[model samples]
Target: MTQPPPPPNQPPGPPPGGFGAPQDPPPGGFGAPTPPPQQPPAQPPYGYPQQPQQPQYGYPQQEQPQQYGGYPAQPQQEQPPQYGYPNQPQQPVQPPYGYPTQPQYPQVPHQPVPGAPGGGRKLSAQLQIVIAAVVAVALLIGGGLWYANSGGGDEEPNAKGSSGAATGGGEDGGAGGLGGGGKEKVPADTKAKLAFQLPVPTVPDVTDVSGSWITDKAYVKTGVNSVVGYDLDKGSALWTLPLTGQVCGASRHMTADFKVPILFEATKRVAPRYFQPCTEVGLLDLTTGKLVWQTSITGGTAGDKKVSFSEVTLHGQTVAAGGLDGGAAFDLANGNPRWKPQANAGDCEDLGYGGGEGGLVAVRKCGSYDDPTVTVQNLDPLTGRPVSQYKMPPGVDFAAVVSTKPLVVAADVNDAADDGSGVSDFFSIDEKTGKLKAKITADSKRYAPRCRSTRVEGCTQVLVGNGRLYLPTEEHDGSTGEYGDETNEIVAFDLANGRMVPEKTDAGDRYTLIPLRMDGGNLIAYKWPPYDKGGQVVSIDGGTMKSTLLMENPSDKTTRTAETSFSSIGAEFRYGGGRLFIADTLISKTKASTSLYDKKYLAVAFSTAG
Candidate 1:
């Protein structure tokens, strides 16, 4: 089918004010992402790789541009991949097939953070300006597109329901999925450029993102109605489908070996009855923005309902969905049910299913303080048959699933008494046989996800904006079966065991550690604390754990009584223009005094940056 050529004007043509080309690709080379359908860890879905910015390791250190001084200082001269040279992502390994799909980050209760009793020295005026510059540029550039996409012109979104294109979200829903949601509908004709709008009506949270930077294509999830994908270079909607809800997207994309889009969606719905629907998967064709398929399991929002989750691949296919018994799998091409393991009902827990030269691996768990059943089963992605299953020690239960190199890990969770004291355990199980490969746990207090020892449930699966697998853990307590407190620490571990980087944060209730790409290899971490307190977005120094604060609360320096919670961020390509889309947390309705957190109601495009 010959498609309509893009309009006369398009992006990748010239920069605003015809500035120099986005120079500073990383030192080695551009993180070249191959064409179509690949693996996990979706990353910067567009542009050339910027210069490399090494993150500091253990202690707090200052970030020096000299460390990434390899690339030429010029921003122009960036080009596409060469045919003969094999361009692999300079980051994490390839993701699985049949990727996850969603719009906004799901609303899960995060860890509680206490306001730090102490205060650090206020930053100097010079430091504040530098930090403000990045954000200001981001806001200024992104805001323009956000306005144009936000239906400044009447758009018939619900009418041409399947077709999509919006202004990138502004401070409202500043990212991709943020602009598209269950809110008021927009007209179909209100087409804005890449920085214009996100595909989803709300912003999907940003999780585990990693990939080579290239302007080939990117993916986005709008409201429950559909998921839209686009070509990164041109910034246009490839396809759109009516799947509905705020969806969450993965950071790392599958490698080019597989002929599929690296992006997908997963949505969670909050009903009036306090019935939070289970999570369901959504897949989109990156170029066409078409809804290729959705999960078809019973009880799941889109058939697969799950709280904790994991996904694995086998024989070029991907499986790892939640079910009444456990997570299920489907063929990537046609959403075919590949396998269905017996239903146990603990919590369908997290999943890790992958098939490679070694063998197929699948892990599933079900249990908690109330749902009692701790079974970790390893199976074949192609056969859906279990080769082994491990019983979580009686003291602990499995929280969410995490992906490790040679194994699939579950941040072991300890059952808690009514008093709220929990235990912790960490184990890296063989992805092939489901056997316990390695287990780490602290003998003292429970291992908390926020601690340096306890592994954050899905940390391994998290892809820093750069292409790498960053697993964050605290400590694991397998004995007493309780999780630790936030006082421990947060660290980004190199899955390959090359180096363990412990990143620090000022936020007390730090939960997840988010990584974003700014320029070349330069990466920044967005630490979202659990409570109403604002978090920090830090620039890391590869050699030291030292961080440079890029942004902080401008007005609300001290934690205010207002319950402000940040939501997830989504990564999507901005079509027909020079922009990347994202879903961000503008403001939430939570009240701090109540000790309550509100689920994300909407996501907006906060700003735009290269």
Candidate 2:
């Protein structure tokens, strides 16, 4: 049978909600008045299983109705002006104590004195001296107040003083120190400084450039039909490996030695047949900048057609590729066939596989096309056999594997999530027994983890490590009370019982913190840049939940603009060895109307080392 045509690619557009856009604060708004703090609600134990009140296993009904998820219900009131923009209707109020106040002067109408020569009366020298002294005193007081309130006369807030850092270690496999186990080196100073930036390569049209990785010696990134390794500190190209066709899929995880699996087309894209089947699989060695091996397989009823794949992953010594053509596995070292697709009972098909340090898990589909049953299976890496499997609840036609080891899967059950994010619930299962351990309902409007609806491993902003699931809460009003200034925080839920952990790491005012990946037991996170600030990278200790500032990008106008060019939704972020690399997954041709200020970047790097 001939393989199906590839899916059409959507044109890229600006990210929604005006994220990273600057807005003026409302007049006289220094910050919103701080509200009295309330005691936090009691948290359930990690191991105690709590039944959800709602009928669905993953979506629990909340006691209070909220305008958005994870936020408290508010009394009906007029909608506030958009963040970063001024509100004209708001009346000016008296300034707070210690704030500079305009000196008040009596508004007495000027009257010509009978003995005066002009329209205004003249004052004696003594009276003039008194007026000068009062004016001078007011200026002195106002200047002092302004200096104190403006961050001690500094333009930027000091990173060290503004944020708290984790010291020593905590229980439950706490991330001991920066670059845990000395596998990655920590800079003497964690304040991030600009290292270098790579200009976006000129593409004839819109192109896909989706892969990136970090190593001790280089930062590797995929370009237009090529992969380039750059010096970790200098941003200069160390090596470049060109390919015949465009890269279609790349594994998120790499082998211990830095070899990665990637899927590409058999030939370069040409007219009429713009997209070729992504059939070729290859292992790329980052250290040597070479393709160690490349191979393709034949499948279908006749066993003579080349199998096409939409995704690929590596687990131990096996590299697995899967798609509508079914799934196949090969030896990672020699590209030898390990297992080929076979007819399954009940018309079941292996859609894709998720592989990592933990193990390899496959998302299997069964039943008719209209009504499908999806199952998560823990497969033996060497021999393609399921050791254990957990059947998903009915109506879950698709599932994204968040993690393979602890077996965390995300799904949109019965079209309830509604949000395009493709997630409404998370299931934690016991891999050994294929039993459901816990189910946590995530409200689509409240949480911000995103996954591709059809891809098994295409998940981002959600991380599973140290027995917990970490996700970012939707951006909300910051306490500073400045209109248009929004922020968010990362909260963790216990994997054992689906109960939320009490501790959370705030993104601070105007910054949005997103989980990048795990570093040992620590969570590496990227702080999305606000209009006036540069992006930041920090390490959040898994045990204590304190954040140690890792890399702080430059806040200058040009640097800030460049750093934020990559949208958070589709960009790839990698942090290690005291550096942060941000790269765009797709690049399109610049339109004639595009302004010079609207510069595009292929990748940007920042480091804390000199």
With candidate 2 superimposed using the best TM-score fit, by how many Å does residue 331's alpha carbon deviate from the native?
0.3
Q: What pairs collide in candidate 2?
A: 23-84, 24-84, 32-481, 58-441, 83-484, 84-484, 192-552
**Distance from true location, Cα of 167 in model 2, Å:** 21
Provide the overall lDDT of each model, using Cα atoms, as 2-decimal numbers. Answer: 0.32, 0.67
Any runs in candidate 2 off by more than 4 Å, and if so which? 1-186, 301-303, 590-594
The worst-scoring run of ten residues by lDDT in candidate 1 lies at: 144-153
Most lDDT-accurate candidate? 2
Compared with the true structure, what per-residue lDDT tens digits does model 1 show for residues 220-294?
434343444444434465555555444333323332432232222344444444223334554445445455666
Question: How do all models score by TM-score?
Answer: 0.41, 0.71
